[model samples]
Target: MSTCVYVQLRCRPGTTYDVAEAITLKEIHSELYSTSGDFDLLMKLYIPTGEDVGKYINDHLLDVPDIERSLTTLTFKAF
Candidate 1:
């Protein structure tokens, strides 16, 4: 089964849009949203089976420009 995760992105001031667009272009996220609080965006994604979660996030999301930081949370049970 795929690994489900929620990633919170913190972007450089005025660059949130740029970051969002870049991420959307990748077409890797299941869902993404703009939110208030410590993070500018929240992304839901499914890492394919056998993929390393940390490396997957680093190789995909972390490379996008304007993304200053990220926090990833792994899910256990859906219900």
Candidate 2:
């Protein structure tokens, strides 16, 4: 089974669009949403089995610029 994670990103001032564009360019996320509140963007990612979750986030998601903070939610099973 694939591993799924939800990431919420807090972007630097006036940089939400840039950050979201970068993420979209990667073609990695299953879904992305612009949100109101503490986070500027929410992304849903699917990682293939045997991939390292931490490393994937660090290498891909975290590399985007203008991301000031991130919150990751790991999923187990779908009901």
Candidate 3:
């Protein structure tokens, strides 16, 4: 089973596009979207079972340039 997570990204001013591009280059996210509100982007990630969620996010998403902050939400039971 995979661990599903939703991550909200807060990027530096005018850098949302750059952040999105960086994310695409990583090729780890299942889905990503631009949004309004406290966060600038919404991303859905699927972490392989036994993978460290925090570390995966850190290396794949948080480490990307232009990402100022991130909020991660874990999901259980779809439905």
Local accuracy by lDDT, each model: 0.96, 0.95, 0.93
Q: List residue ranges in candidate 2 displaced over 4 A.
A: none
- Write one digit per residue (lDDT tens) for candidate 1, span 1-79: 9999999999999999999999999999999999999999999999999999999999988999888889999999858
Q: How close is every model to the real structure, measured as TM-score?
A: 0.96, 0.94, 0.94
Could you arrange the candidates by TM-score from highest to lowest?
Answer: 1, 3, 2
On a 0 to 100 scale, what is the lDDT of residue 42 in model 2? 96
In TM-score terms, which candidate is top? Answer: 1
lDDT of candidate 2 at residue 68, scale 0 to 100: 98
For this target, which candidate reaches the highest lDDT against the unseen true structure? 1
lDDT of 3 by residue, 1-79 (tens): 9999999999999999999998999899999999999999999999989989999898767888888889999999968
Give the Cα error of residue 52 in candidate 3, in Å: 1.1
Candidate 2: global Cα-lDDT?
Answer: 0.95
Candidate 3's displacement at residue 11, Å, is 0.2
